[model samples]
Target: MRNVVLGVANTVAAIGFVLFASIVWSAALPLAIGLFLGSLLGPRIVRRAPQTALRRGIALAGLGLAVYLAVEAYG
Candidate 1:
């Protein structure tokens, strides 16, 4: 139920991003920024208390760093 809604919303967002990317000059930058923010914040919203928060924060930081490197390598 909730998962399905979230999945659908994410899919719609992805499609919207693709459509916008096709027409926008520098869409990748915004996409990257969005990814970074989502990675940094999403876990905090979903994770339980205590250790989960720490784990999620570390995971998000790693994701952000990886995205940054990938963008720099390709862009």
Candidate 2:
């Protein structure tokens, strides 16, 4: 399924980010803590939300980012 693939990809990306932070960033501790908290709390928060609202918000955000990128590209 698409969600499964995306979830796997996101996990890999998160691992890569943590590895990079550990190797290069002195703020890795805080970064790791924030990531840990997000991982712990994010699913619980999202699970209770309305799916339609979340989808709409994501679409709006993507559209806004696209418009911003277009303007930035043209300017």
What TM-score fits each model?
0.35, 0.51
Tell me, by lDDT, which candidate is best.
2
Structure candidate 2, residue pairs in collision: none
Writing each residue's lDDT as its tens digit, candidate 1 over 1-75 gives 999999899999989977775655387789889999999987886565577777888899999999999999999
Q: Per-model C-alpha lDDT, please?
A: 0.85, 0.89
Off by over 4 Å in 2: 1-34
TM-score between candidate 2 and the true structure: 0.51
lDDT of 2 by residue, 26-62 (tens): 6768888998999999899789989999889889999
The number of residue pairs in model 1 that clash at the backbone is 0
Candidate maximizing TM-score: 2
Clashes of each: 0, 0
lDDT of 1 at 23: 57
Error of 1 at 2 (Å): 49
User: How far off is residue 22 in model 2, in Å?
Assistant: 14
